[model samples]
Target: MPSAIRFSGVSRHYGNVKAVDGVDMDIAEGEFFAMLGPSGSGKTTSLRLIAGFEQPTAGDIHIFGHVAQGLPPYKRNVNTVFQDYALFPHLNVRDNVAYGLMVAGQAKAERYRSAERALDMVALGGYGDRKPSALSGGQRQRVALARALVNEPKALLLDEPLGALDLKLREQMQEELKSLQRSLGITFIFVTHDQGEALSMADRVAVFNEGRIVQTGTPEDIYYRPEVPFVADFVGSSNVLPPEIMRDIRGVDAYGALRPEAVRRCDAGHDAWVRNVSFLGASTRVSMQVHGVAMTMLLPRGAEIPAVGSTIQVCWQQDDLHVMSR
Candidate 1:
């Protein structure tokens, strides 16, 4: 398969700061690829490089096998959907969607037709006459999406596009965005700090840290079988055990990682004292001190909730522990 975007040892330096340092990546055509990381981790900078908003200080970039180093954003077959929506308040939804075509000297009638189809694709067919202020946040987001789709971009770049929505609406839009990406069969490069969104929506994920990509793999691989302790700790706040804990628990000399949910309460297991308990409607999160180290585990809704300050025995599958070569 052709790569929708490729970065070969790309580095973007700002004299004293290295925003993107030697990033090598390949986003497959039609794949839902997620760049997951915290702020200052270089994920957003990577997206800007792909969007032609920034150029690499060193190395080459390719879009669908074409050299993209000297190309402008308008020359690339890609579009960016930013978190702000960036919609024009004065223009109607239809005209907003067709603005790109209008700038490219498209005919009024033809551009309107394309805008209508784009709006229909986002399930906003009848909202052509509505102003930006009249629509809800989610609706405005859809309008922004429709605007991007109007250009028929081969690869779409999303920079935390759902960051402004409420929890329920964000979750709903996550599903809708996934569905839209699948239907369009175009490359979708999503940049976000939300682990849940990346894990759920992406076919593959690249975890960024300190201006570098630490790991890239399927969600399960990134979650269950993390390469380093940082990936495990950042992705889901997994129990990142040091070398001492690893030797005490598993007779290993290296660092280790264990997911909270994998820790099971057992009567004849290692003794630990409950530090705190948090109810999350569907499950209970328990904080514990085991071997003088903090650990956390999620209990199902129907499971027994251990009171804080109580001693509990816990166990986990041997295979569930991921050993890291520190």
Candidate 2:
């Protein structure tokens, strides 16, 4: 498949600061791809580069086989949805959604019709008359989506679009956003620090760190087979076992990643001293010291919870232990 967006040796530097440094990526057409990382990791900068909001210091950016670098945002066939929604309080939802078309010299009748169709796509069909202040946060977010979709861009660039919503609302929107992307069959480039949001909504993910992509793969590949320690620790809180621990367990002088949930309670295994037990709704997180190394295990619901300060035997399947390459 052709690429919706491509970056070749892309770098955006500010004096000594390299916000995006020598990054190469190919985002496929009609794919839902996520750039996942913490703040200042260059994920947001990458999105901006794609949207033409920021220019690359040295490299090429191609959007649908056309050179996108140095082009204005309006010239790129892409739309951006920001976290703050950026709605106009004075205008009604219909007018707000049609603002882009209005600016493009579209007539009132045509722009309003396009805006209404976009609003319907976001399930806000009847909210055309509502003002920005009259709607809730989620509704405003949908309005933002409608506004972005009004132009029917080839790709959608989202910069933490669900960041402002509450947990429940965010979860609800995740599903809706994924569904909408599939239905629209357009490239959706989502930038977020939330691992859950990326893993749940994106078809593929690029894990970023220190202005570079550490790993890029499907969610399962990133979670189960992290190539480096940073990815293992950041993506799902996996246990980054030291080389000594791996030597003791696998007779290999290398670091390994073990999922907390992969630690099983066996009658005969390594005895672990429980240090803390945290009840987290569906599961209990137990912090333990194993062979002098502090580790954690997540006990599933309905399982017997061990009291803190107690000792228990824990074991893991060999397959569950992923030996890191670096």
Candidate 1 segments whose C-alpha is farther than 4 A from its true place: none
lDDT (C-alpha, whole model) for all candidates = 0.93, 0.93
Candidate 1 lDDT at 55 equals 90
Error of 2 at 325 (Å): 2.0
Question: Tens-digit lDDT track for model 1 on 84-112?
Answer: 99999999999999999999999999999
Question: For each candidate, how many residue pairs have backbone atoms clashing (under 3 Å)?
Answer: 0, 0
Model 1 weakest 10-residue run by lDDT: 317-326
Q: Local error of candidate 1 at 58, Å?
A: 1.7
**Model 2 weakest lDDT span, ten residues long:** 68-77
Error of 1 at 167 (Å): 1.4
Off by over 4 Å in 2: none
